[model samples]
Target: MSSANLDPLSRNLLIGVLALAGTLASFAATTAPIQAAQRGAYEVTLPRTLDASGRGIVSGTMWCSEGARCAAPANGERAVSLCGEVASQFGEVSRFAGPQGELGSDDLARCNAAVVRR
Candidate 1:
């Protein structure tokens, strides 16, 4: 039978099936991991400053990494979160303004020194 002879519901079902198939094909094509291997590194830096309430302000850059996913926070801030394998090795580093009651130089050093395998 010709498509024009098909009922509205049947036509709609066919269209939906075709659209679904097209979407699945496109997704499969783009989702395959590229054979090319990407490698890189990053550097993070923060300013040594204190706020009125004694919270540390930090700013830094990340390079090599795919994105700016590993940089410190900006001014008027107290702390920032670090993560990934690097963070695990280096203990999460969060710079706070003022005197950290329990967190001191030793803690900072340990955290900053953490290294993670790629």
Candidate 2:
């Protein structure tokens, strides 16, 4: 039945449903473009070498590139989320660790790669 011919209660319910849907559509439209425009990327390096027993050792540093193409949330918490996403691109976070032995002493080669912004 047409909304105009429906009871007051039914008419109000229909209107509310339509309004809620419209609000959701607007929200999606507004955010989709913003997310697409915000571009950012990061690179994580891992060093691998065989140990005395022939097991491989993995460790390295993470680097992020900055510029107009690289965009991340200005907010601290949200920015951290972006950083987490960047890190995930490489692999799990556990793969990254500090120098295994003595403090501030690592014998591995340094990572000098740059991140390309998305």
Candidate 3:
């Protein structure tokens, strides 16, 4: 129903409720994006495409798809450590970039060392 048909008291109440809802919606909108911005992301380029088997993914936080691409939420971890996990799951990382920036050559070497010896 339209607010114009309401009694004055009910109209004011409805306006107050809508204003409060708008305030809450705006507050929620601000905070959610801020939290997401604070949590940086990780992207990886693998040396090869992961097999279509379940082994392709690293963890719940990391998602692998579309051939050699993988991504995860950085979640305050170092590039080196996160890269190691990705390398361990999939294989050597062709490129690893995260909140702390891309892994250096030495770091990449160390990260790849965690690869399973299979």
Which is the leading candidate under TM-score? Answer: 3
lDDT of 2 by residue, 7-118 (tens): 9999899989999999999999999877744532222223332122221111232333222112222222232233344334432221222212111112111111112231
Expressed as tens digits, the lDDT of each residue in 1-118 for candidate 1 is 8879999999999999999999999987876533211212223322322222222222332212122123222222222223232344323445322222223556445545553332
Show the lowest summed lDDT stretch of 10 residues, model 3.
53-62
Q: After superposition, how far is residue 104 of candidate 1 from its true place, in Å?
A: 38
Tens-digit lDDT track for model 3 on 1-118?
9877899999999989999999999999989878877787888888787777423445457465557887766677667877787787777887898876788899988898898543
By summed lDDT, which 10 consecutive residues of candidate 1 come out lowest? Answer: 35-44
Better candidate by lDDT, 1 or 2 = 1
- TM for every model, in the order presented, reads 0.29, 0.34, 0.72
Better of 1 and 3 by lDDT: 3
Better of 2 and 3 by TM-score: 3
lDDT of 2 at 97: 25
Residue pairs clashing in model 1 are 41-63, 41-64, 54-97, 54-98, 55-97, 56-96, 56-97, 89-114, 90-114
**Global lDDT scores for all candidate models:** 0.39, 0.37, 0.77
Model 1: lDDT of residue 25: 97
